[model samples]
Structures are given as C-alpha cells and as structure tokens.
Target: MTEALSLVPTTDARVARAIDLIWREADLLDRREYRAWDELYADDALYVIPIDRETDDFASVLNMVYDDTRMRRMRINRLTEGYAIAAVDAARTVRTVSRFVPLAVSDDEVTVRSAQILVAYKRDHHDLWAADVEHVVRLGADGDRIVRKVIRLVDSEAAVPAAGFLL
Candidate 1:
C-alpha cells in the first residue's frame, strides 16, 4: 500500500486532524513514548487483537491481552515500571502507514482503515510485520477531539513472543 491521500466527504479540518493524530502516533511509537502513546487512546476504548482467522469477534477466543482502557494503562505502567523485559530494553521500531481510507463518517464518529508495516530491531535481530488496522475514532460531540479510539490488529494469532511495543 502507498501513503496516498484522497479527498472524501469529510470535514477538512477533521480529516486533517485525524491524519495528524496518526502521524503523531507513529512518531511517538518510534520514539518509545509509551506514556504519551497510552494517553492517545480514549478512556473506554477497546484494543482487540483477533486470531488470524479473519474474524473481529473476540467473545470466544478472547485474543485481547489489553482490551480495556484500564488494562492498556497498566500495560503502559508495566513498561515504565521495569517489569517487562522488552520495556526495559525496548526494541528500535518504526511504523509506516499507508492507504488511509476513510470508510464511514457519522456526526461524531469516523472509521479509518489503513495498512501498516512495522519493523523492529532487537539485539541485532530484526522483525517485520505487516497488517491492516482499523482505527475507530469517535470525535467529540463538540467536534473538538477524539473521544474514543479502537485499534484492532489484523495479525493477532501469529505466535509472536511478546507485544510489549506498540504498532
């Protein structure tokens, strides 16, 4: 996928802000800003890592290790608390976002679908993962900011070691 931008039937300001937010997230993740990254999420948003079978439902498999806002915060805190080894010696990572297509836009909710490629280097080893992530952001009722943002990783059953770093 390519980082191509298209004009949809969305408010120019909102679309611009969304793209800016995504880019900021990319920068933060690359810089290992765990706390700042955590703060970007909504208070009650959900992070779902589904099994690789092409299903979004997480009721049975329960593929989410960090599903709720509180859990996500704990994950960030754990990273900073020096409990997770990957956090202590974090991997050098970068995420390239592409094909940012706006699927739907209600009054205060917008859905962005994009493909991302994340590369990480750890201890002279490199790992690259590519997947499409759906970002559901609920713009505040006052049209000021994002109220809720949901992230669902496409490859949640890849048997990877630990997902200590954000994509």
Candidate 2:
C-alpha cells in the first residue's frame, strides 16, 4: 500500500499567505472560473508547461507553453471562445489539491510545490479519466501588489489526455 504524504513547512507569514492564495487559485480552476483565474496573474507573469521527456535536460526539450500575460489572455480567449471541445467537457472535471509546500521563500517572492489529482467525468463517449500532477508556482512582486506566477506540471507527457484546459 502507498503511504500518506505531508505538506511543506513554512514559518514565514508571506509563505502562509501565499499558500492560501495558491489554494484559492486551485479552487478557482477546479470551479472552472477562468475569468478569476486570469485575474490572479501578474502582468509580466509566466505560465509554463515544460514537455516531459525521459531525459532531464529541460532546456533542450520543448515546453508545451511558456505564456506571458498576453499569451495567457489568449489562452483564456480560446477557451471561452466556445470553439474548443475540451472546454465543452471541462465543467465536468474536478481536481483535488494536497501536500502543498513552500519550497523557497523570499522577501519579494515565494515558490510553492503541491500535489494534485484530477478526476474527470465526461458524457457517454468517454470513461472517467484521472491523473496525478505536481505544480511548481513562482510568485513575484508587481509594485505594491504581488504578481507573477509560473507553474510547471510534472506528469507523463504521453499519459495526459486533453489537458486542453490549463491545469
């Protein structure tokens, strides 16, 4: 049997606050609130999906995405545009978050890593699908407000089916 895991430790107040934000972010995504999801990013923020490979060389392999604010907006646009089939089936998925940890904490930034499990139920065409994923998020400063979020998804590239929707 598999043993249970624990969350990351944090003594910093910023880390605690950031963890809350991260949780809220995950909740928003699971709830399919893309508009709120878009609001969470810093203007110059980046959202990256590095392509999974057998090798450890990230720079050499292609990343599924490395989106800046504009690109992220485009992503939101495409999903809400109603032309994407995945989005049609998207509202049926639910993702659960756990084992959230603060890997690194700084005065102006925080990096968090968390475990996610998503279970999706589509119509009669597809059976239920599920996956376990890890996210590495980088939070940075944008003036008085905090901005910037970079997420790395750790999963088997081939195993992923229609993550057409951002994780």
Candidate 3:
C-alpha cells in the first residue's frame, strides 16, 4: 500500500494568500454570489474559457467564454437580471479546487495553476466538469485582484452544458 502524503509547510505568505483567495473565489461561485465574485477581479481583468486547448488567442479562435471587464459586467448583469434563459434553469455547482501551485510570485503579481472539478446538478441531471485553471493575480494598491483567468477544460472539444454562472 502507498503511504499517505504529509502536508508540506508553505514558506511564502503571498502563496498562502493566493491559495486562500482562490478557495474563496471557488466558494463564491459555488454559492452563486456573483457580485462578490466580481469584486475579486481587477478593473481590467480578462476571463477566458477557451474552446480549443491549443489556442490562447481568444480573438482569432472561437472560445466558450471570453469576457473583458465590461463584458464580464454585462454577464453579471445578465445572470442577475433573471431573464437569461441559461439562468432560468441554472444548476447548483459544487466545485473542488485543489493543487494550487504557484508558478510565479512577485510583489506586483502572482501566477497560480490549479485543478478544478465542478459537479453541477439541475433537475434530474448531473454534469461533471474538470479543468486546469490558470490565474494571474495582480497586486493592486488596495489588495490583490485577479487580472486574468484562463480555464482550459479537459473535454473542451466535446459538447458541454450551458454555464450560466461564474466558473
């Protein structure tokens, strides 16, 4: 039998903070707290859920979701308006966010990569979504905020359910 892995002590305070922020974000999304989730982003944040695994150029390729700050605000408005068809039958999500590895860390920015498993339940249907999420968090004068979030879905090329809320 394999031995249980022991938790290693993390040395960097920034990394700890980033992990906390990521977990809080995931919790907010799971709770459908969109307004609070939106506050975690920087003014010019870019959120992308790419359709193609090989392409990072959102402008040139078709993406599942690509939203700049204004577009993100519109999305939040649409979700909160109660008129969006996708939101009408929105699924409740339970997200498992783990393996938060800090790729890069600095005083001004922190780049982290993590794995996410989202289980969504609506009506009688349940869907499982998995992805590798990359977050570029910028350290603002006031606090840390996400500047970019790229969600590379493992089965992005396959057909998936409508994502009405933040992921």
Candidate 4:
C-alpha cells in the first residue's frame, strides 16, 4: 500500500498540517488523554467504524461503532470516570500512520486518507490491527477540528479482540 501511494507527495504545507493533526490525535489516544483527545473534534463530528468493509452507508447498514458528538462525550466520560471497566484496564497502544494522501482540500475543510497499524500491548499479550483511516477536518478560526473519522478495519468480518480504547 505504501508503495502504491508513493505517487502522492507529502511536501504540501496543508498535507503536513493534516498529518500533524492526525499524529497528535493518535498520541493523545495512546496516552489515554481522553479529555485532550475529545477536544480535537468539532461539535458535529462523527466517528464511525463500519461492520462491513465494503460499505460506509451507516444509515442503511449496521456499523460496528457510530458516534456523534453526544455519544463521543459519553464514551469519553465513561473512559475517564472509570465507569468503563474495559477501558480502565485497556492495553496501551502505539499507532503508526502512513500513506497520507489528500483526498480533498478547501479553504475550510481538508479530507485525508491514510493507512494505520495499531499495536496494543497488555500484560504478556499484544494485538496488531490494521485499517484504512479517513479523516475530514474542518478548519476554523480557532484551529483544525475533526469533522468526521471513518476507520475500515482490515479484518472486519473476523472475530477480533476487544477494542476498549479509541481506534
């Protein structure tokens, strides 16, 4: 995949900014900085993980996870407040994001597509997960904010380990 995406240059300033934002978000999530990570999203942001890898029509098809701002707030609250036991004991994660391609760019919005490899480590155990990640970021006077994030897991149809933390 990386080789296939080599045609797209990563030197553009806008692309650099978008990639930086993505890396920051990943770092925050990996550190379990829920509040800080939540702040990266726009008020109307949507976070989605489709159950079927071939489809992204969340309204018509069931999704593994579909979250709006309210749902995201609840999720973050649970994780931070210790109400979610799985999250409280979730493994640490290190994510590598690559193949960043600018799908669309405008004065107020930037859409980027990338490949990700996430490694989760727990006591004497670890899991490796891969996915294609899309992020629609809205640029505001304040800064860049995430408007939508879609994650297509490579093994969506297979039984997978618990994903208590944000992908």
Candidate 5:
C-alpha cells in the first residue's frame, strides 16, 4: 500500500530523526543486540504484530504478537538467556525498512508509516517477510522512545514459515 505523505516530508527534521531511530532499531535486531533494542521503547510501550490488516483495535483483535513492556522483556529474556531464537530455527537475517511516510509530526511526537522487507536464511532455505509498519515515537529530554509499533504482515492469513528472529 502506497501512502501519500499527509505532511510535508522534509519540512520538519523530526521526521528524519524518527527514521534514524528506526534504522538503528533494524540494525540492533539484525545484530541480536537485545539489550540495546529493549532500551528504545518507553515503559508503557506496545509492540504488536496484528493478524487483522485493517484494524486499529489491536487489543481486542487476534494478533500474532501483542506485547506490553513485561511481555517484551520476557521475550527478550527468552531470546537472550536461552536459545529461543538461537536454536534449531536460527536464521541469519537482513531487513530493510523504507518507503517512509510521516503521518504526524509534533515537537514531542512523530508518527511514521513505512514498509519493511526481511529475508532470513536458515538451513539452506530462504524465507521472506514483508510488512507495513507503523511507529509512534515519543520525544523526551533523555531520548526518543517508541510508544507503539504495529507490524501488519503482508500475508497475514497465509501459513508463514516459523521464524526464530524478531520481526
């Protein structure tokens, strides 16, 4: 889905800041830097991967993942402490997030919609996952924090191969 920019794309430098943070996130995930990745989110943040493509009510709908801070921390522990994402299905991945459309920009917040394409290689097989991702970032004196992230998978209804890495 192509989203026409709702605001001037280059007028505000906050948009650029948001993109830079997003790129940093993608890199941390690729490198399995779970600790650093965890710090990017706010205390009340949500990280969601919803099965419903058109739904904004993520809490009431069925989702592949709906993680609050506690849940996210648990997931990170599983991925880092043990072998949850490092075991049999361990895949080397490279992901690119682009096609940015700034939906909202303010002094204290920036909302962005973008496209992400990820490729994971495991056991001589390659898998592709594509999604439209939305991020709501909160600007702060300390640092910018992600307050919400919703990843809508392209083939949500189809059977996707199991992935060991975070999307």
Candidate 6:
C-alpha cells in the first residue's frame, strides 16, 4: 500500500478542525475568493510544488513553485489586480479533496495527507490534475492556520497544461 493511504482517517477533534479548515480553503478557491484564501495561511507558511517527487528539501532543490509570504503576495496580485485575464482565460476549477490520512496530530498542530482531484475547464476542454496533498495546520486558540502546503502532482514530470486556478 502507498504511504498516503496506509493509515485510516481519525475522528479526533483536532483532525476535524484541520480538515474543516482544508475544506473551507477548497471552497474559497472554488469561489475565487482569493483574499479569503490568503487569510487561511499563517505568516510563516510555505506553499510548494516540487518537481522532485521524493525530496522534501524544497528549499535546497528546484521547484515549479516555491512561494513564501512575499512571493505569494506578488502572485496573488498578478492574478487579482492585473486585468480580467484571470477571469476570462483562467480555467474554472472545481476540486475534490478526500481520502484523509492523518500523518501527525497534536493539540497545537496537525499534518494531514489527502488526495486532490482538480478539474479545470477552459474554453471547450476539461483537464484533470490529480495530486497527493500534504497540509500542516497550526492549531491556534483563535483559529487554525495553514503552516505549510505541499502539492505533488501525479504528472509532475509530464507536460502539464496551464492552471488558471490555484491548487
């Protein structure tokens, strides 16, 4: 069995909280609520899509996308401010995240693994992007915030189409 699906889902309160946040994030993305999506992350969060499937040292390795706070802000700006390009040409994406596997859970934090199938529609074509997603959530007293998100696309080494929406 694959590591991601080896473990079963849990009913822990912390896990529920983390999964709720993740689902909310997914809803925000589908609704094109970029600002709300931005608020879901912590200040020290890392958003990464690595080309190397096995390496976790994203800082030292090459990545398709590695966004810190500043970079993420800039990218969001490009998409939300520049023009209606993102609205017009950007693919309409609807993503399903399931098969929850709690990697680590604690009172202060939770790291979960899940499967994400994102369907993007552009013009007359519909494309599917399947990935294994790992989310590290910091459970704060006020609310939980995403500390790190790593999306590993199944076709990372193949020629992938342009994604008009954020994964």
Mind giving the per-residue lDDT tens digits that candidate 5 earns over 1-167? 32346645844678888888899999999888988999999999999998889998988988889999999999888877765646335788899999998987887888899999999898788899999999998888899999999999999878888666788
Stretches of candidate 1 off by over 4 Å are 1-11, 141-155
Choose 4 or 5, whichever is better by TM-score.
5
RMSD of 1: 4.8
lDDT of the structure predicted as candidate 1: 0.67
* Location of the lowest summed lDDT over 10 successive residues in candidate 4: 1-10
Residues 69-146, model 4: lDDT tens digits: 999999899888887779889998999999888887666777889999999998889899899999988877889899
Models 1 onward score TM values of: 0.80, 0.72, 0.90, 0.91, 0.92, 0.92
The lDDT, on a scale of 0 to 1, for candidate 5 is: 0.87
lDDT per prediction?
Answer: 0.67, 0.59, 0.84, 0.85, 0.87, 0.86
Q: What are the clashing pairs of model 5? A: none
Candidate 6 lDDT, 106-137, residue by residue in tens: 77888899999999988899899999999999
Give the candidates in order of lDDT, highest first: 5, 6, 4, 3, 1, 2
Candidate 1's residue-wise lDDT over 71-162, tens digit each?
Answer: 77787788789878878888888889877777766546567777888898888988886777677666665433334443445456656657
Model 3: how far residue 66 lies from native, Å: 0.7
2 or 3: which has the higher TM-score? 3
- lDDT-superior candidate, 5 or 6: 5
Looking at model 1, the pairs that clash are none
Comparison by TM-score, 3 against 5, better one:
5
What is the C-alpha lDDT profile of model 2 across 20-135, one tens digit per residue? 77677778877778888877766756666666634334447677776778888888888788888877656365666666666655556666556666666655443233323333
Q: What range of 10 consecutive residues in model 2 has the weakest lDDT sum?
A: 1-10
